[model samples]
Target: MRAVTYDSYASDNSRLKVGRVPDPKVGPGQVLIEVRAAGVNPVDWKVMTGGLDGMMDAMFPVIPGWDVAGVVRGRGPDTPDFVDGDEVMSYARKDVVGAGTFAQYVAVAADDVARKPASLDWNQAGGLPLVGMTAQRSLDRLEVGQGDVLLIHAASGGVGSLGVQIARDRGARVIGTASEENHEFLRGLGAEPVAYGDGLVERVRELAPDGVTAVADFVGGQLDTTLAVLAEGGRHVSVADNTVDQHGGHWIWVRPSGAKLAELAAMADRGALTVEVAGTYPLEKVGEAFDASRTGHTRGKLVITP
Candidate 1:
C-alpha cells in the first residue's frame, strides 16, 4: 500500500516521505477502510516532531494521520456494526502512533469508526471527526446549553468553527474570537466575532456585559483573558492548555468515539452543523498540507485525498 511515513522525529519535518508499506492487518474488532480522504491537523506535524512521544508509543516509519473518511473494505471477526462497502469516517488514533489514516488503506477499531454524514462530501467527512469530536467533548464538559453565553477562542479554525455551530445548536449565544478577516465567517456560523489579542477582554464584555457564562479556549495562551471575561461561577475548558485546570477549568483531550461522531453526523444531516474545508491536497502533497497547517491561519480544515 502507498502511504506517508516518517522514520523518526525531526523538528524540521524533514523525515516525511511517501512510499509503499505493508498493508494494515485487520484484527478482531477492527475494520479495514479503503482510504478516500484524510484530514491534516496540527497534531500530525507535532507527532512527526515527537511532540506526543510521552503519551503515545511510536513504531518506526510511522504513518501520520488520524482523521479518515473511506469505505469499509473488510471487517474483522466480532465486528457486526458495519459491512463491506459501508461509507465511514473515524478519529482513528490508535494507542500506538503507527498504522495511521494517511494511506491507501487503514485498519481502525470498529468502536472508533462511524458512518459518514450523507450531506458531507469526502473531504468534509474526512475533516469532521477529530475537530468535530474535540468541540463536542469541550461543549459537553462545559455543559453549554440554552440561555448560556459561550465564548470560543480561535473560533474560526477547524475545531472552533465546529464548536461555534454546535454551541449555537444547543441554544447558547456564541462569541467567537478570530482575526478581522474571519469575523464574517464566524458570524455566518452563528457567532458574534471578536478580534483576538489586545483588548480581547473589553470586546467580549461589550458583547456580554455580564461576561460569558462559558469559555472554550481552542487556542492556548488565553488563560488570563479566559479568567478575566468569564462570568461569575462560569465554566471553562481548554484543549491547548492544561494550566486551565489550575484555574478551575477543565483541560480536555478528545477520545475517539463512533457514537459521538454519529451524533455529529445527525447534526450535519439536520442542517444544524456544517464543515468548512479550506483546501484539499493529494496524498503526495502531505508535506505541503502540513506546512499550511503549521501557519495557524487557515479558517477551516485542510484535507488529503488519497
Candidate 2:
C-alpha cells in the first residue's frame, strides 16, 4: 500500500512524503477500506506539526488523515454491519496517528464507519464526515431548534456552512458571519449573512434586534463578539475555543459515531444537507492539499483522491 508518511512532527509540509508501506492488519470489529478519497483538514496538517501531541500519541512513520470515503475491501470477524464492496465513509481517527486514510487502504473500526450517502460522490462523501459531525455536534450542544435564532461564526466555512444548513433544517432562523465575498454563499445555505470583524455585533443585531437565541462559534477569538450578540438565557458552544466555558458556553469536541454518520448521510440523501468540495489533489500531491487547507480561506472542503 502507498501512503503519505511523516516520521517526525514539524510545522512543515515538506515532511510529508509518499511511499509504499505494509497494508494494515484487520482486527476484530475493524473494516479495511480501499481508499477512494480523503478529506484534507486543518487538523491533518496540525497533527503533522505535533499540534495534538499532548492529546494523542503518534506512531512513527505516521499516515496522517482521518476523513475517508471508500469501498470495503474486507472486514474482520464480528463486523456484521458491512461486507465486501460496501461504500462507506468514516472519521477514522484511532488511538494512534498511524494507518490513516491517506493510504491506499485503511483499517477503520466498525463503530466509526457509515455507509456513504448515495447522493454524494466520492469527494463529497470523503469531505463530509468530519465537518458534518462537528457542525451537528455544535448545534446539538446549543439545542438549536424551531423558533430559535441561531448565529454561526465563520458560517461560510466547511463546518459553518453545514452548521447554517443544519440549523435551518431544524427550523431556526440562521444568521451567519462571513466576509462580503461569501455572503451570497451563506445566503444559499439559508442564512442571513453578516460581515465579520468590526461592526459584526451591530450587523447581527440589525437582523435579530432581541439578540440571537443561540451562538455557535466555529472560528476562534470571537468570545467577546459572541457575548455581545447573544440573547439573555441563550445557549452557546464553541469548537474553536475552550475558554467558552468561562462564559457559560459549552466547548465541543466531536466524537465519531457510525449512527450519527448514518443520520447525516440520510440527510444528504433527503436533500437536507450537501457538501462543497473547493479543491482536490491526487494521492501523491497531498502536500498541495495540505497547503490549500492551511490557507484558512478556502470556501469549501479540500480533498485528496488516493
Candidate 3:
C-alpha cells in the first residue's frame, strides 16, 4: 500500500513522503478500511514536527493522520457490528502515533468506527470526524444547551465552525469570533459574528449584553477574553490551552467514540449539521495539504483523496 510516512521530526515537512509500505495489521476488534479520503489537520503537521512527541509515543516511519472515511474491507476477530462493504468513518487516533489514515488502507479499532452520514459525500465525511468530535466534546464539557449564549473563539475555523453549528442545534445563541472576512461566514452558520483580537470582549459583550453563558476556545491565548465575557456561573472549555483548567475552565482533548460520531452523523442527515471541504488533494500531494492546513486561513476542512 502507498502511504505517507515520516522517519524523523523536523520543522520542515520534507520528511513526509508518499511511498509503498506494508499493509496495516487488523488487530482484534478492528476493521480494515480501503480509504477513500482522509482529513488533514493541524495535529498532522504538529506531530511530524515533534510537537506532541513528549506526550504521545511515536514509532519510526510513522504514518501521520487520524481522520478517515472509507469502506470496510475486512474485520478482525470478534468484530460483529460491521462487515465487508460498510461505509464508515473514524477519528482513529491511536494510543501511539502510527498506522494512520493518510494511506490507501488503514486499520481502525471497531469501537472508533461509525457509519458515515448518508447526506455527506466522501470528502465531507472524511473531514468531519476529528473536527466534529472535538467540537462535540468541547460543547459536552461545557454543557451547552437551551437558554445559553455561547461565545466561540475562532468560530470560522474547522472545529470552531462545527462547534457553532452544534451549539445552535442545542438551542443556544452563538457568538463566534473570527476575522472581519469570516464574520459573514460565521453568521451563515447561525452565529452572531464578532471580530477577534483587540476589543473582542467588548464586541462579544455588545452581542450578549447580559453575558455569555458558555465559552468554547478553539484558538489558544484567549483566557482573558473568555474571563471577561463569560457569565458568573458560565462554563468554559479550551482544546488549545491547558491553562484554562487552572482558571476554573475545562481543558479538552477529544477521545474517539463511535456513539458520538453516530450522533454527529444523525445531525448531518437531519440537516442540522454540515461540513465544508475547503480543498482536496491527491494522496501524492499530502505535503501540500499539510501546508494548506498550516496556513490557518482555510475557512473549512482540507481533505486528501487517498
Candidate 4:
C-alpha cells in the first residue's frame, strides 16, 4: 500500500514522502478500512514536528492522519458491529503514533469506528470525525444547553465551527470569535460573531452584558479573553490551553468513541449539522494540505481523497 510517511521529526515538513508500505494488519476487535478520504488537521503537522513528544510516543516512518471516511474492507474477530462493505468513519488515533489514516487503508479498533452519515459525501464524512468529536467533547464538559450564552474562541476554524452549530442545536445562544472576514461565516452557522483580539472582552460584553455562561476556547492564548467574558460561576474548557485547568476550567482532550460519532452522524442526517470543506487534495498532496492547515486561516475543513 502507498501512504505518506515521515521518517523523523523536523522543524519543517521536509520529511513527508509518499511511498509503498506494508498494509496494516487487522488485529482483534479491529476493522480494515479502504481509504476514500482523510481530513487534514493541525495536529498532523504538529505531531510530525514532535509537538506531542511527551504525550504520545512516535514510531518513526509514521503515517500521518487520524480522520478517515471509507468502506470496511475486512474485520477482525469479535467485531460484530460492522462487516465488509459497511461505509464508516473514525478518529483513528491509536495509543501510539503510527498506522494513520492517510493511506490506501488503515485498521482501527471497532470501538472507535462509526457508520458514516448517509447524508454526507466522502469528503465531508472524512472531515467530520475529529473536529466533530472535539466540539462535542468540549460542549459536554461545559454542559452547554438551553438558556446558556456560549462563547467559542476561533469559532470559524474546523472544531470551532462545529462547536457553534452543536451549541445552537442544544438551544444555547452562541457568540463566536473570528476575524471580520469570517464573522459572516460564523453567523451562517447560527452564531453571533464577534471580532477577536484587543477588545474581545468589550465586544463580548456588548453582546452579553452579564458575560457568557460558558466558553469553549479552540484557539490557545485566549485565556484572558475567556476569563474576562465568562459569567460568574460559568464553566470553561480549552483544547489548546492546558493552563485552563489551573484557572478553574477544563483542559480537554477528545477521546475516540464510535457511539459519540454515531450521535454526530445522526445530527448530520437530521440536517442539524453540516461539514464545510474548504478544499480537497489527492493523497500525494498531503504536504500542501498540511501547509494550508498550519496557516490557521482556512474557513473550513481541508480533506484528502486517497
Which structure among the candidates has the greatest lDDT?
1
Could you arrange the candidates by lDDT from highest to lowest?
1, 4, 3, 2
Question: Looking at candidate 3, what is the lDDT of residue 270?
Answer: 99
Select the stronger candidate by lDDT from 2 and 4. 4
Reference-based TM-score of each model: 0.99, 0.99, 0.98, 0.99
Model 3 poorest 10 in a row by lDDT: 196-205
Model 2 agreement with the true structure over 1-306: per-residue lDDT tens digits: 888999899888778899999999999999999999998888888899888999999999999889999999999989998999999999998887777899899999999999999999999999999999999999998888999999999899999998988899999999988889999898888999988888888988999999999999998899998999998999999988999999899999899899999989999999999998898898788888888887788898999898
Q: What is the lDDT of every predicted structure here?
A: 0.95, 0.91, 0.92, 0.94
lDDT by residue (tens digit), candidate 4, 110-225: 99999999999999999999999999999999999999999999999999999998999999999998999998888889999988878889999999999989999998999988
Q: Counting only residues 3 or more apart in sequence or on different chains, how many pairs clash (N, Cα, C under 3 Å) in candidate 3?
A: 0
Which tens-of-lDDT digit does each residue in 1-306 have in candidate 1?
Answer: 999999999987678889999999999999999999999989999988989999989998899999999999999999999999999999999899999999999999999999999999999999999999999999999999999999999999999999999999999999999999999999899999999988999999998999999999997999999999999999999999999989999999999999999999999999999999999998789999999999999999999999
Tell me how candidate 4 scores on lDDT: 0.94
lDDT of 3: 0.92
